[model samples]
Target: MQINQLTRAYRYDGIDLPIPPHLAGDPQALRAYHATLYPAILNAEAIDVGVAGTVHVTEYRRAVGTKG
Candidate 1:
């Protein structure tokens, strides 16, 4: 008899980039991923994470239109 285990991680971004478990759990790595998803957050004055793990930009300004 043989046993095998497989685990997969996908970045929160819709692009489906594979993420290793270690990087996913790292706070700094998580922030980089977040910046990739919402570039505006790079300049955001404040950020809030909800109980459900949702990220909210509490304060930000846009030169023109906004994205993300």
Candidate 2:
């Protein structure tokens, strides 16, 4: 349940959960991989949460004319 921050090419804001080695390189595969792992991670209480019982969420946005 340890979420690791990933390196980005430019300044942007987002949540970076480390993709397990088994899910490397493929975005579609990663989604499936997470589908399997997330339940376990949540069961283990590895997910962050908000004060009112919501899962902690993050947002990513591009600056005025900057690519994100």
Candidate with best TM-score: 1
Best by lDDT: 1
User: Model 2, residue 3: what's the lDDT?
Assistant: 66
* Pairs that collide, model 2: none
Q: Each prediction's TM-score against the native?
A: 0.32, 0.29
Which consecutive 10 residues in model 1 have the weakest lDDT in total?
A: 49-58
The total of clashing pairs for model 2 equals 0
Q: Which pairs in model 1 have colliding backbones?
A: none
- Candidate 2 on 1-68: residue-level lDDT in tens? 87655431211133355556655656456544444634332222222232332333322232345445
- After superposition on all CA atoms, how large is the RMSD of candidate 2? 14.0
Q: Across residues 1-68, which tens digit of lDDT does each residue of candidate 1 receive?
A: 96544333333322334455667557456546656767854554433322232322222333455667
Model 2 misplacement above 4 A: 1-16, 39-68
Each candidate: RMSD: 10.1, 14.0
Write down the lDDT of every candidate, Cα atoms only: 0.44, 0.38
lDDT of 2 at 53: 26
TM-score of 2: 0.29
